[model samples]
Target: MKKLALAAGVAVSLVLGVQPGSALAAPTSVVLAASQASWDQKLAVAVKFGLGDDFALVELPDRDFVIGIWDHVKDDPEHVEVRVAAETAFAAAPEDTDQLSYEFIITEVYAAFDRDVERERQEAEAKRQSDLARSAAAASIDVVADAALLNGSDADFVRLIWERVADDAKWPKVKAAARAARDGADSDRTAFIAAGMAAAARQDIDDRIAADEAKTEAEKALERARASKKLAANRIGMPVTDELLNLPDRDFIIRVWNFTPDGSEVQAAAIAATRSLDPVVWKAYIDTGLHAAVERDIQIALERKYQADRALAQQIKATATKNKDLNLVYWTDKALAGTPTQLDDFLRAGQYDLDLSTSFGAGEVLPSWSNTVAWTGGIVNVKPICCTLTGPELGVRNEPGHTGSTSLMYSGLDNNTTKSYAYLKSMALSRITVKSSTRLSYWIYPQSNTVRPEVKPANSTCVAIDLLFSDGKNLRDSLLKDTKGNRAHPAFQCNKVTVGKWNEIVVPLGALAGKKVTTLVVGYDQPGNTGGYRGLIDDIKIAD
Candidate 1:
């Protein structure tokens, strides 16, 4: 049967003479009319029935308290409890019955009871929300940690509880249990926490067994992650433990183990990684690396050959005809065809009559900014700005050439925001003979882009090479370029030029027909702020 509300149930029980049962259960109301009486109406009924004071004792405008009282006191129709309450009110009045008012007392009591009921309801709701939050926090402990707690490895479980359940009512019990597991050896820790779990679950040792099992699984996973991390470092070629540069080979990298191997998981993984690579792949890698070493040796050999051929170059330059001098021609051809697969292709490219350069060739010329050689043109300043020159000689060893040419490192820059130019020229070399078939060529190695504002600047914003030639009468800028193609010059920059490596720049004499030339100038010009622009010059040649 559906029960009526507290006040209504109490009122109906009173009006219909139904005896109240226990504190928890009230009988179903067959009469809905009395059960639905208003609060003021119920107060009036309680006053008229001479139970107004007893009603106030309920501390709420509800019938549960009344039902409880009925169980304790109600035995007759002329209820002694109500009579005693009324007599007590009268006796305490100190006035006659006419002055006594149970109605006013019941009204105040009913209002106070309503407030108390609301307060109690609010308190109960707050408690419920608090419990929900705490429960959620406890359940939110990491699954890994939870399993750890159930098993014997309770470190994660202890830390999780400390973080989430610090303020919980049940925290102390679990905290002590987790602390025991965390602080003790595996067996002792599990035994203590399991004992606590046994009490909370109010069961036997099976709960403890489950906890121990869960802990074992969580710990196993932790160990595996640790091992994998250490192994990953080895796979990527870092130190598996102490030494990185030299590590043991594949066979020594890992050892198979049947058990947990307690303190050696990472060691085992390192060994396994090395073993995995022991077959044909590692040998292939070693073979591939040998190519660079072989290439370096080849460069050394070529430089020696070049040094031996300098006297030969002078002899050939003085006498070789357009198609003769096979030795000089053969070697020159080889020098130009870079890194060819066959020696024939290598020996057929740099066909030249002159290799008028240096591997800084057998001399220690001092670095002089002033050009003292009368045949070699002096450094000229094109801008109104003053610039400083560093080395145009042999002894300054700052930058190195290909096979150590004792390179020319020239930088002519200042702190000026205006333009400046400092360049090396070959104005006096008119008598060094080249036949009608002659062209000038040399290798330019870049530490920076040779092109100006378009390419990235290394130090100087402008770098260029110019050849001054006489159209039989006046010397003019015959070829003006900075290693990039310029149609205006029409002599140099005949093809695409790349920087950061040696580039063979070849200029045919036919391009300068009816012209006599003496000067080859390399110039640096710029608005100067980043100073010290440097380039490497090597194996300069005038060949047929």
Candidate 2:
């Protein structure tokens, strides 16, 4: 009869599509299955007959059925509360049919799930806060490290480190070590940052245990000795080694003495410190004396450079005067009269770009000889029948002048005048006087192409100058030679003239040194050419 009832309940559950708490119309069809029925058959009858709240207990004899339910709902998103509760109950008694019952699955599973969810939320929030705190701590550590490196004061740096990490629980060992160094002697603070803080930080990361604090006095003294040797070696670019670190105090000082340049301040200090044979002296020299000596050495080197620069400036000034480059002379004078920086500037580039001809001294300007009309003498002579001088007018041009607002230009056309000659002469200047030491200097710009001649004593420069005297004598017959050693009568010839650039002509009155000047003349004589011609002149001065 139990088997028949169980089969009939399963059949009714399948046909009616009923759930666990549905109402049934026929009481006979809804009869409860017997105790020996399988759990699925009992569940089917409970669903078909709506016996969820019945007083009689449904016998779930097989524990696998509840285990299957737990496995199915454990990962079901819609049954999170039931899944967690079921997990809890299964953990407590996985094989106990009483705890695995449907009644416990609906009630305790949801309550346990809620509690676990809240616990996970709190843990996630705590981890986020910890990450943020670590980030902030890292930034603060960077700032403090930068300040320490720049300040160069080990004691103050250690104190700052202590204050920064004092309340930070993550760096407990670092904080303690920094505090001890902060309140200790200056050497203690220096030693801490040099090595102690790094070791403490490593220990804190590995395990939060107190560091060893039982260093013997002798051991501390030995550490200080090694650190001092290393610091000195590093400062002087000497390699630090175990043998160097273990040297006797005097021998160590001797090593530093040898490492420095002979006769250097550091070497002298090292020798003095070594003579004392005292550890305190050695420490003091390493800590402060070496730095002071190095500074003194630098000042000495700078003083030597200053002296050398002054000597060089004097030499340059003399050379500038010899070259007759007044621009260079002016700049050198400024350098001599100003600071060392100005002297360096003059040597570097200031003297190279300025016009040397514009600044003249020991000279006299003749206002009557200022323009082209004073020198042209109203004469334009052109040779050869085919040659014609189209223009010989004098005008002022703004550029290509040696000095002043405008230069005197004399222009004319050749008109196919091959092997022709043209000349311009100055009117008589009987009012001007010449002395034995008199010298005439002027600059000229020739606007023509210069060609080398195939044959002939005369080159193709086509330019010359002559000085006339009161005795009707010219420069060619006189003993006067221009600064270039060429006779003043034929100044520009044989590559001596530069075309398209200003050229200076200086004539010293050698034979006619103390005579009155009659006239000044300029000429063009190209042996085998014909074209337009132009030239500029400026800054006519007489010097001695």
Candidate 3:
């Protein structure tokens, strides 16, 4: 009777929804079959249609609901009842409008149901794999820990085991086991490893401490040696100290030359002892040889203290010249640990064009000769192409080999006028210079002679040639040649006068030989002239 009632209802639905032979009503038939099919078959159909999770659940709530729906359509025996139930469920849904809506909903619901099942399966598999990984990690930790405990005394073994494990969290146990092994019996291998590790660490620390102590001792010895140096004032009235010998630290070496009063070796000894630490002190003994300034015997005892300063300088120069990087030398009292510098070969003065390719940015001014702080190592006799001026006129003054002070100004008319001078504001001579008989050379051509008229006082109109010392003092003075004594020269005369021609002037190196030459400043004295005196100056060269 129930089956009969269901058939009657299905028939009524067909009457309301499908025409006797309409193609549009075919979907309605499919929906009814889906709703009434067996749970398994309905699930299969749902997967094919890609129904959502909730829709699949909505279709098959329980086993019995499936059975009831199936029973209503079972009479057909062609499984038509399943399609009828699906069609009915779709008709009942909120979104259904056309009779075919039920068929579409049933198809979608079954698809989503299949996807949900597959997703669950994948999740379970992932969890299983994760558990397996954790188990493997835990097992590895056990193996590492056992290895550490068994051979804790051997630092290499322990270190090797940890390398295999490579787990930071497990380090504590390994460390503890190692410590225990170190404390164990001497015969224990684990303890031996621990001892080795400790010994290595101790050795490293000891080495550093020794190095620091040596440095400290060297510094102290240098201070004492410098204090005892003999200084003499040269003709330029600058104090020049005698040469200091440089030596490196070594176990045993013959550093001090000519120990005996007769320039013969007396006793050779290792350099490790404090008494023979520095060579500078011993050089003093050599200076006042066998017949010492104080006691002859004292000089003999101090022969080993002398170090060869000149030899050291030569060595330093050799090494520095080979260095590809920008090499700069600075004077220091510190004792060199290796070869010393030989400054003589590197101290020649010549016009130098500063090579500045290594710097990072542009617009960087190249250093000119005479700037003491220009290159490394205190200035010797070198000519700068132009001064990198300071103050407001820094970038403004572009002429090479120019030096000037704010106090002196140049008159554009004559080179001698100092009223408004054209100067390289920041340039200055180094503290060290060459002071001997020197012939100054430069080409000077005046564009005008407005300020210091052609005939000015001989002494007053003279161009001061100063061999500036490092301590801010000039050493020489020379006047422009008096071709016509007491008569001033015109601005346009080149060959005979100091104007309009590129005249080659020669200066003697002897002028800068005895005294240290830091800078060479060429300018006029007081009553200086101002602008409008134009001089085309070039090629200021210095040579022996």
TM of each candidate vs. truth: 0.26, 0.30, 0.23
lDDT for 82 in candidate 3 is 40
Runs of candidate 1 with Cα error greater than 4 angstroms are: 1-359, 363-399, 414-418, 433-436, 448-461, 469-476, 479-484, 487-499, 527-530
Question: Per-residue CA lDDT of candidate 3, range 1-544, in tens?
Answer: 4543443443333322222242210112223232434456545544443422324333543322333343433343233324323333322211222223333344533432443444355346534433332222222233312433442334445445446434544234444444554446543433323233223223333344445555676675554333222110110112223343233322112322222134322222221222565664444443222112222333443332224334433443342222211112222112232322222122211111111111111222222322122112111121222235321111212333223211122222223342222222122222132445344454443333442343232222323223333212233321223223321112112224344333444445453353333333443222333222334334443333
- Ranking 2 against 3 by lDDT, winner: 2
User: Model 3: residues >4 Å from true position, as ranges?
Assistant: 1-437, 448-466, 475-497, 509-513, 522-531
| Candidate 3 displacement at residue 213 in angstroms | 64
Clashes (N, CA, C under 3 Å) per candidate: 14, 3, 94
All candidates in order of lDDT, best leading: 2, 1, 3
Give all candidates' CA lDDT scores.
Answer: 0.36, 0.50, 0.31
Question: Which one is best on TM-score?
Answer: 2
lDDT leader: 2
TM-score of 2: 0.30
By lDDT, is 1 or 3 better?
1
> Candidate 2 or 3, higher TM-score?
2
